[model samples]
Target: MSKLTQLFKKAQSNYDNYLKRDNVDGLEETIKAFEKISQSELNATLKKATLTELQNCNEVLFLIAKSYTAYAFAKQKELSYTDAVDSLTKANQCYQDITNYIAKIPPFSLPLDLGRQNTEAEFYKHKMKFEQAKMEQFFIKHKMTGAYDAEKAYEALQNIATAYSTFQRVLEKSYKYISYKIDFGINDELTNSIKDELSEARTLLAQAKNKKSKRRADETPTSKKNDNGNTQKKRRLRQRVIIEEESEQIESLSSINHSKEEEDTYEIPASEQEKRQATSESLPTAMELSQSQPVPLQGLDLLSTLAMSFFAPPQNVSSPLPRMSSTLENSITAQPQLENTNVFWNQNSTHIKDSQECNRLLNEWSLIYFNSLSTPVSEKDNQALTLERLGHALLLAAARLQKESQFFGQQKINPALRIAVQLLSRSAELSTKHFNPELTMKELSAQYAPLLKAFANPGRQLYNLEYLQHLRRQVYKESLLINTREASVTDIVTASFKALANTCFGKDYEIVRDTCFEALLSATYALSKNNHI
Candidate 1:
């Protein structure tokens, strides 16, 4: 069995033990086991599992939450208020997360009985219990001091009230669902009691607010005196210092607890640590490698270089002539030698000069093409001619880039090709708008049929197919714009099939074919349902 299967089995066994024991001991262990199974690997396994398997996983998670609640009750019975609060909080969060997952699954997909569990109601009830425990803990801690922090106490009370209200609201809606129609003995009675409690809690909260305001008002003069007098100011400063020190202590304790939890979750064995250290020591150092290796040019860098070379003006070359000959025989002999030297220099620089000229020409051509695209086309202009020119120019630039890419490697070609595809697609759109072909459906299909066939070249990359798909969509959309009835379902299906078929010869062919086939099937189904078959 796989590791996930083993983990699931372990979780199930622990859950069973927790259920049988009816105590917090087994429940704590079960929660820890479940937390381990909640790691990313297990999550990926669960996602890839079948629907039935996923349902079983969710069922286990739900039972775990129920066990947590039971554990909280057991802790409460032992008067372990802190432990009880912690368990209840975990239970509340688990229920909320499970409810969210259930919501994402289609309503019809869930088991009928699973919906009857009322996870949302459980979440709020546990949340209310947690708040109550927290308030009680606060009161217990302050019992010796005989001093109440109105803000903290009131906040706790407000949370309790909110949780109770939310729980009642969820329970009310639960009664309407068929799955929740079972006559639980105390559903209605408990809901009513909760409503009554919520009302009382709100009243107490309002009273607390009034009391706090009155106290503040009574202390205003004393607070003002403390702020003004030097002795009072010193006393206030001492209180501030004490508060900051207490806050620091609390923060440190929380951090220590967090670190302990992390250590418990991912404890590494001494043997594993030794192995990791050995592996690190065995690896070669970067400084030991040769430094003269040429760094391969990246796609972005290459494109930038191409852009700069195309736009930058050529640098002037200066050559100073040798001192003029003082004698006729010396001048004649020097002239012949200088001519030979100049011929040799030109021969050596021919490649560089040619490359520069190519860049200059390409720059000029691109500027002209973009300028024409930006310029408005007239009704009388030949749209086909304009499109051909733009398309050829883009293709030429792409070819030159591809040639340059060979000097680097294949890995650097894709980025430039993607940019070229975008330019070509944009040009296609401009062509369609300019032409605005007003033809019958049959005529439009015939016109685009050759173009589609020409574009369906095998051995093309995925990006190439993506561009073709974009072109196909634009063609159909433009056809619809010019003549509403000038495109047919057959045209669309044919184009889609051609594009998909082109992927059969590329890398990851099987995966791409399956995906494209599914997409095509979905599109065909949609078309048939609309009576466009």
Candidate 2:
């Protein structure tokens, strides 16, 4: 017999032994033995093993790859997600190459672990399963804090939905053609996970569309507000017109209303007129006035008086932040009056560079924004852009620190992440997009994603993950993890009652009643279990 046939037979024997132990699906030995055979030079010699033997080897590889994918789902093992995904990817790629290698081989009696022959439907099922796992991994890793923007999220979800449809077709075909045994639970799991990340991704996509539509609607064909080329001229022109109109109206109103004596009292002075003209010449071109010109002792008061004059400002009124539309600041929340946000922009990142240079290029912008966080989002004309940019800066900084752990030793974890949650939350209110990239390959290891999502789009969204408890499902798991203590069972019971008694049952509270109560009940039971009886 050829060396290839001998090796394939030996690997088949090992896989046979493993299956006898009641693992109908191939497991540890099946993977190792077939993997060695695949790496061998004999695998390239198609004539070494009979056509039937080659098909059997391919079936074994498919089963192994399927097991690896299930392992990645956290349905198996407590290890980091890196190991799981790598195994799945390697197995998936290997199976794909080998399948192509034997593509010319005709369908035959490829015996299965189920005492029946494998069919073409089996191949289709394996392909769909692998694709679904990959999409899930992608969605989890890139859902919030990474370079995975709304479009990526939307596409990944669509792919997941496609998998769901494929599985349904696979089951129906299997039944119709008497193919390999298909499990009903396959449909259940697909329906559950693919629900295409379900409403969350769709909601983000919808909100993104709305933001774009609103932006386009707000655009004026006459004015170039979105133009970065000549914002200074626009600002200067707007101020000049406002000042001139105010001066003219005041002079005309006084000309009709006042007598000669009264006219003396209201008469415009030459110095004042010159000052108004000069002020008209300069109304603090965007925020550049803060950096270039020294504010006089009462410049803020003077500027405020200049700004709030005469005409009620329209929705598209000019703002002090360069190239940022004032309409974008419609519902800005006040900046958190915290210590880090006071001046230097610490955990909060409230301060930034005092110039327009940061927006010139992506790399330079990233650098400047990363190094300096001296700007407040609330004060920006485009508060949404400011918030998203600052959040991205923090996310980038966190990712760097994570990468630098080898040389820098352990780093503080939550400060940047916590602040980023706040920023992204406000940004999502204005525009439902988090323009960041993957922090890590692992799905759950990227915890910042859930926190960011929960903050940004949180409003009574149901999270049905059985793995995480109430604290993590509906709230920040980080804070709950800290200072956890063993309280008496009675204490937990009493606390629950006290909470219920004190809480008001208004319409806003109604939205979260079930979510909060589930959390409370689960927390109480868990604490009771962890504590002394």
Candidate 3:
């Protein structure tokens, strides 16, 4: 082989070795060494050169450098903008290095070789893109807020970004192309089947809830007690009907068998016979009836509840009779003593030994709870009637407690009676104040007014029936004129009688002795004698 061929072979081997380097530092160093050796060979060729020889050397060196640039980039440890720019810079330097060699040659009468310009253009294009990518990294990845000078720095970067047919063209080459596909593991048929099962389960759950709600509704004390009372009343009616049917059947049989004898010779004596006949006539049969069907005695269930509460000592109830020293017991007996007895209620009240005081306190507490109501009872508003009923129940319970708590033959005044009187008085006042004029307040007064009158009566000494009669008379009189479009003095007196009837338990003297009626009727009569009943 020629010496030139040997040197060329040596340079090729070294260039190949440089191409194998992947690390930036090693690749760059090897590239520099290869360039230096090639340049030395080109220089030696130029020094002795024939034109053909020089042209061959220049072409060979150019091809070698271009091949090395591409190879160095391929073996790059990391393919990023920084390394790309660095490689482009090295390639530009190699081209510039050849410029010096070309400058020494005679000027050619050729247009400027646009290849250098094109190469420079491509290098600048990539450089701008790299810088823009770095800026984009700052904006998109790092979430930078400040302004980016991408205009001055990477003008062609925007054009390159827009030309991308795919993410692979980007300087970073790290973008992902994301897409989605429906998972048909569950489809229309499966979905419909699940819906059917879910609907059926929901229906069953609703049925269960309804059944539970109905059971709870049935168990409410009001409905259950009303049903039980009605049932008992029905049973009594059935018994009464049976008795009347049997009696009528017996009378008919007797009358059919001995009609003439029953009329002519059935009497032992005139008076005795008449008496028996009269008794038979008076007796209610299947046909003959009386007004006001008797109300069947339905024993109060609440009384039973109260008895259970009284006799069965709850954990918190303190029995005053047993005289226990427990804190719970002290709490109960001390309720009347506490200025604010509202705090220690059911828990300590069970221990209450003094039945009278306990009853009184309970009634008082109930009345207080009732008096706390606001008006125009809406769904959201507290109900006045509920509180009033609670007070009534408490009073009824207190009555029982009063009797239960008394010692055998130890006649002590029932404090509950006083409390009952006070509560009734307050209830009457509230009823008068807020009660609709159309509704007869007499119903409430009928229950409580007699008790008041009995308390106020001078003759009874134990009761004051006179003052009660006076108060009730006023209530009735006022109620009568309250709503009357054309009420006169007469209306006031008539109402007073109705009030008297309810208050005095239908006693004849209730109507006669009412003070307001006496005054009202007297004035009416004085004005017109025909106005008297």
Candidate 4:
């Protein structure tokens, strides 16, 4: 006999011993034997083994034995009702092993009754019970080989018939339950009911199949209907169209819910908007509130504080130390605030002072903005464009703010000469930092180079050193990292010429900057030569 056949026969013997003694003595020994056998290697002949063969193999027998551990625990006399529950638990483990192996096959379809708790232990218990029921039913309905006792087989089949019937009915009931998703809110109870029904069905099926057939000896055919109204009636098979349609609907609903909740921000009502603003205005301004209990100020309020500190120092302060502390703090705070305020100063005096300071800064930043524009930047890579644009915008803002400052302070600074000088120096520095072809370390040597000297025009000077070179360098470094090509000599020359062409020497005199115009013409010629190569 094949190893699978031998394994089944051995299991049968062990089971018979258990029925006679109601103990695990023989079963344990059989299990050990099966475990050993499963570990033994078989040739390629086993590759052709069918599902039946695999079920009857030593491997399955070993699993069945392992599954009985829970039952063994339950069997102890000292154990309570909880201990007796071990039988189902052990059976569950075996069922899981069987299911896991079965699921690996391609295009596998688990039986409808097999939809138990989906846990390995529960799955194994259900699977083993079903398989055992199937095997018993098959044997009972069919006769065994030589040495089979017809009397015992018939007796066992009759004993298991009711159990098999009950299991089948339960299985059918569960099939109906899942067929229509009956949801009364308590999913757990519904699920448990289904599992219990399936388990019962499997047990009944196994018992019914265990009986040996005596049909050949008896000349007459037995009636299909049983005495207890539990007849083996034919069942109608269900079609897949309804289930497929329901599944599609569930999927569509899930997709719609996801799309609805995906936005980064949501809108607020106008009433809520008014309430939030009212709450904000109730808070004290930074100046009104003392340092120890400083009122809540937003991040950009620092720039406003700095500008106010510069214009209106508290008239009562005596010591130089406190004045220095307050000034430093105000400057630091004002840096962030400048970007927050698009419109600055309401009164004429404050506006004039702020505007004068801003204009001086604007002149210097203007020079930086024009110069950076002329520099060759990569048009190929997308990242390069973003950095270039960011640099361009920052410089433009710097110029606008500076212009506003100078316009505000024009009346106070008299012909704004002091602000004018400050503006001219920083504008030169910005030009050298961004537009100068050579990043020379020489101590202001050749500081009066055409581009730097061009910033000296009384009409176009910028005062804010803080606004001058820092942002230009930041943008330039970022551009370099993003660009594929390095800023070459020819690129520098072209950029310088472009900067000169765009700059205003004065409102009325363009001829004063003839050297720059000549340089542009030369750079154009140089570019033509490089293209031919």
Models, CA RMSD each? 33.4, 33.0, 57.0, 37.9
Evaluated against the true structure, the overall lDDT of model 3 is: 0.31
Q: Tell me each candidate's TM-score.
A: 0.33, 0.30, 0.19, 0.20
Overall local distance difference test of candidate 4: 0.30
lDDT of 3 by residue, 327-420 (tens): 1001011111111122223433212232233334334443444344454444212222322342343344333433444331132222223233
Off by over 4 Å in 4: 1-5, 37-48, 58-74, 77-93, 108-533
Error of 3 at 183 (Å): 54
- The runs of at least 3 residues in candidate 3 whose Cα sits more than 4 Å from the true structure, single-residue gaps closed, are 1-7, 14-30, 35-53, 75-83, 96-533
What local distance difference test score does each model get? 0.37, 0.34, 0.31, 0.30
Residue 19 error, candidate 4, Å: 3.1
lDDT of 1 by residue, 1-533 (tens): 33433333344444444433443455566565555654466557555655545444444555555556555555553434344445555555554444444445555566533353334334333333434433343333333135555545454444445445444443443334432322222245466667666665566556556656666555432212222344455777878756766676676666567546534522211110000011111112111212212222121223223222322232332221110001101100111111011122233323233224333443344334434454755432333333333333333333343344443223322222222233233333333342212111123234334333333323332232233433333232211111111222223223222322232223322333333334334433554555433
Better of 1 and 2 by lDDT: 1
User: How displaced is residue 479 in candidate 3, in Å?
Assistant: 99
